[model samples]
Target: MKPGRYIIPKGTYRLTDKLYLTKNTKIIMDKGARLLRDHNAGFFINGRTGDSFTGYDGNGNITIEGGTLDGNLTARYKHYNAIGLARGQNIVIRDVEIIDVRGAHAMDINGCKDVLIEGCKFKGYDINYTVDGDGASYMREAIQIANHTEAGFNSFGSFDAQVCENVTVRDCYFGASANNPAYPAGVGNHGAVADLYMKNIRIYDNIFDGMTYAGVRPYKFENTLIRNNTFINCDYGIRYSNPNGNGTYDAGKAQSGRNTVIQGNNFIRSKIRDIYIVGWVKDGITARVKNIQILDNIFEGVSNAETMYLSFCEDVLIRGNISNITSRFVMGYYSINVSVKDNLVNGITNEVVYVSDATADGSTSYVGLGYTKDYYISGNRVENCGRSAFNMSGLDGVEVHSNVIVNASTETVGTRSAIVATASTRNGHNNKVRGGLWIKSRTFLNEFTVDDYLRKEVKLIVAKYTK
Candidate 1:
């Protein structure tokens, strides 16, 4: 039914199956107002201000178009999503701005299907003063997706049981103030602006800034694609994990989280690490991570703490990226079947790559073989590094060939090793070190070339390394 030119006053509950607000009319769900059981319908709080609408046990679909939902919405106690397809199908929330909900989630989708959230702005309330020890607190997140259970809904029971499918979030903006008290004191433990747990998801072309946590967190699902997003002044740009107890979490799971792709994004001024891939081990056996590709991205002015941290995975590829002004590029522990190539690191302070068989506890305890075979590090460039440009410790069957290293020196002595191979039991060969000024003993069995650029590419190949 159409309610033409009506205003939902403050502190009132507008309950209906399908209620439509006419164009240019106002429906205000003022401070402390609620709406319940809007089943299989649509509501247009069209072009209004100071209108608040809350849904309880609401199902099917609801649309808040071109207006402001300026109050709190509570789906924590209800059994359905606060917005979009709550135990229903095909919901859409477009062109709305929601704000000033203290410690409340913006939207929740439970067992919903084919949901789309576009052109929306979700933000937390601003906080000015902090109570010293009690950091800052505001509205939690913009959107959440999970499944239903009997153990008193909204608790998010098991990672496996919460099955959300075919979700899309595009062209959205998520922002929180930096002065919020809940901001982390150090790196590696910040909160995200949005958390997503679903299958067959596509998140693209969004802008996320001033968030205390990760920009996007995808947990326990597959065939997910995160591309063309901008993350600024946040802690972690994106984090992918498998919270379920499955031995394999790729784009091939029952929900298809097995083959995930993160490509063509920008991460700038991140307070902590930019990207993280965490695998939860069960029964003393590590999970297999396959077909995870990170390609064609730019990481500029990233924090010096850590950039890319990978743990317990196989068949991972990191290629065609550019990093500037970073402390470390990649740190791997207990990783297998990995390839890092065709990347540029300019003005790096620490080692470009640190690989070890050692876990946190330095023992001869080999959890598994530290194998880096059939690996290639080619067509990369490093300039003005503070420490060793390349440090490989305790690696097997590795190759560091056809790379250019230039101007690796500091003020304090320039004694840094250009390429330090510590206790390497494998063959290190065919490495052409370009440019002048070489450090470390040149007693290793490898070919070295010092070519003149004016001689072109033909005569220089026969002149430098052969002599």
Candidate 2:
């Protein structure tokens, strides 16, 4: 292992181990350099006769400074990751341009910590097929952090799941179509590796677009933070996937996340579900265990997005966010101890907030209430919503306070109040509205209408607070 600079000449180089890599090695690919991957071109050689690049895991103080890693994606191969890091620490990869990678992730963060992937450009192959290899892998995410059992990787294996910790993706460019139109995703959680969860991953200050999926989609993660990013014209701003991220995980099971935060981001013209938080079902108590927060974000041209489609969560918070042309502000279902407050929302076709899992009919095919309760919606300024400003049903101990609504009634909503709540046909309830105001009327509009929408249910609630 040498500590020296191996300069890649400016030419079309085939990716292999002979090019140069070792402990304390700084292999600099000359600008205008292009590489073709007939096989796995690793960031670091995997010892003797290692054909692929492992990208320095279980090692330390390694840096891969610059290069254009062009995986000749037109063809197919096996056993390759655009970059793989396992058991490595203090690794830095910056100013690298990776293009047309097929059959695997652009980067793999496995059982590593203190890694930084910055100033990088990642674009995945345009095809939809899982090219080659020993498994059902594809050219999927720009970065992947997952845990897989040894048995999952090979036939006869011996090991638990690996854990990735403290990895950061900053100032990178993800397949934004305004530039390349078909860029790939930013990052994804393949699933629990070796039956273990990832810990402490950070995604910050990146520009993402053209992501067929999302800027960042995670699973089985802990204390994850995604902040200060800009997303433009993508299918999903932040998918927050409920099922397995890519659905190809053979690694045991995918666990639910904890203490996740999505803050200070901007999403524009996203086609669906801007901030979708579908919490997974964990073992033990089926209680609402919402430990997520979404704050201070801007969303525009929300088209078909639910804006914030949260479900099966508790103790969640959505505050200080602004939206334009957004469909629904919040569709909180099976949620408890939640709060949606102090936001400005404008939409054209739906209710600004609908906390319903229990409707007059059974729950709609789209929403089913299962003990939905303990929510607070307050101080939000909503307008142009076709349905009522707020609609709640099948609830207990919910509060709607001081929300200012304007232009919220539709022709289809004739004689309906601005804020409506009905007890689910199944659950008896205590839901309240206090200081709720119609902005045009300047006072609390007894627009509070109680109803028996669910097949002859008794009432919307048992009481209300009068000023």
- State the displacement of the C-alpha of residue 347, model 2, in Å, after optimal TM-score superposition: 2.1
- lDDT of all predictions: 0.54, 0.63
Give, for candidate 1, the lowest lDDT window spanning 10 residues: 184-193
lDDT of 2 at 82: 65
Give the per-residue lDDT of model 1 (tens digit) for 1-467. 24333434445354454243332233333334444433422222221223222221223344444444443223312212234223435566666655433332456555556777788766553333353222323223456554533221333222233356787888887775332222221111112112234567777888877666677766555677888888887777776555434322222222113577888989887777777776644555555455678888888755365667766556678888888877767776656666777888777777666666665467545433553333445666766667776666556545565556665544233677666656542454565544324535333445434345612442354345336
Give the CA lDDT, 0 to 100, for residue 247 in model 2.
41
What TM-scores do the predictions have?
0.69, 0.79
Write one digit per residue (lDDT tens) for candidate 2, span 1-467: 57676677778877554233345656677777777776645434312332222323445566877778776655634435666555567878888888765555677666567888898888654444444433324325678776534432321112345567788899998873222334345776644532355778899898887677677787667788899998887777776654432344433333456788889999888877677766544433342334888899998865457787776677888899998887777887767778888999877467788886643356564344345777778778766677777877665555666565655565364455567665341222233343333222212234332232421221222122111
For lDDT, the strongest prediction is 2
Cα shift from native, residue 115, model 1 (Å): 1.5
Clashes of each: 17, 16
Best by TM-score: 2
